[model samples]
Target: MTAEEFEKEAFALRPELKALASRWLGTPDDAEDMVQDAMLKLWAMCADLRSPIAPLARVLVRNICVDHMRRHHYTLSIDTTDVPDLSHGAADAECIDRMMAVVDSLPTAQQIVLRLRHIDGMSMADIAKLTGGTEVSVRKVLSRARKAVREQYLHKM
Candidate 1:
């Protein structure tokens, strides 16, 4: 695809990709940075891929996220102080926000797989392809992430 065509298609998919990145990164700034990097990489290889924004583009985005994690090592963390009394209506949102924070704390690979699978509604096969990992690896990461997130949720509860 030419640059113009690639730009158009990428624009259409930007929202979904941005949301995916934000969920994985836990911060809007980092998500935007990752998305920009992905776009640059996609533009560089625009001629090689076919039109309509190929799956490889998504994979590129995923890879960029993984690279960011590697470049800046992220340690898992959660702040459980002041659980915000779930009796209130806003508690649900607060609880989910805390849970998402915990999710963001996961190791990069596991975080990516988990968010892509659960939050982004991506399949195991798709995540595997995007991450260039085996299906078993994806499942294991997903399982480990879920276990950690579950532990946090239960603790908060």
Candidate 2:
């Protein structure tokens, strides 16, 4: 892709890429950094990239976020502390906490897939690309994760 084409295709998706990073990293500031980093990397290899930069850019951003998490020893975390007070008739914090516990107890792949699908609202194909798994495998993992969380949460109650 030419530099102009790369800029149009890749830069147009900046907000989306940043949002993905924010969901993965848990902070918009860090998300911006990761997105910028990914953009630079993409720019370097822009000539080899194809059109519809969405898929490749998403995967690149995911990889960069994962690397950052690994280096910082971060796992997907749900900050229950910020959950609205249930006493005010907001969302059920206890239930959310219980579900989070169940999710955290799952295997790493399961947790990642579950959160990416349910929590981040990512599509199966996008999740597959980000996680380096086939869409069918991602669906299976997500199904199992959901089943496990439901069973475990009910058992706990």
Candidate 3:
């Protein structure tokens, strides 16, 4: 990507990238720093990057967050509270909360893949790209997560 294109993409994606970084790191300032770091890394490799900036930025931001966590000796725990409201009525809220708890009990990888696929409505390929895994692997993870949630939820219900 050219400098001008990179600049435009970076500007446009700032909010989204920052939000993703904040979500991963749990602080807006840290999120901003990470986004800038990702952007700098992207700028360094702008000439070699062939894909669209969005995917590349996402992958970089995720990597930066992981690196930050590792450096700070922080355990990686995905917040499951962002689960979308699938409840149609007051009675369904309890069910939704129960399901979310089940989801929370899942492995971190399972939680991430499940939320990205079902809650965030991301595509398998996109999840694979973001998570640095194969689409087949993502599919398998999602399948296992769903099955686990189903089995556990049935017991709870």
Candidate that would win on TM-score = 2
Q: Local error of candidate 3 at 69, Å? A: 0.5
Scored by CA lDDT, what does every candidate get? 0.82, 0.89, 0.90
Q: After superposition, how far is residue 146 of candidate 2 from its true place, in Å?
A: 13
Q: Model 1, residue 8: displacement in angstroms?
A: 1.0
- lDDT for position 6 in model 3: 83
In the range 7-119, model 1's lDDT, one tens digit per residue, is 78998888878887887778888988888888888888888878767466677778888888888897667775644456767667777788888988889998899889988
Q: What is the model-wide C-alpha lDDT for candidate 3?
A: 0.90
Local accuracy of candidate 2 as per-residue lDDT tens digits, 42-123: 9999889889888988999999999999999986557666343458664587768877989999999999999998889999
> For candidate 2, which ten residues in a row score worst on lDDT?
82-91
Better of 1 and 2 by TM-score: 2
Which candidate achieves the best lDDT against the true structure?
Answer: 3
Candidate 2 lDDT for residue 95 = 68
Number of residue pairs clashing in candidate 3, backbone atoms closer than 3 angstroms, sequence gap of 3 or more or interchain: 0
Model 1: pairs clashing at backbone N, Cα or C within 3 Å: none
Ranking by lDDT: 3, 2, 1
Relative to the true structure, candidate 3 has a C-alpha RMSD (angstroms) of: 12.6
Model 1: ten consecutive residues of lowest lDDT: 80-89
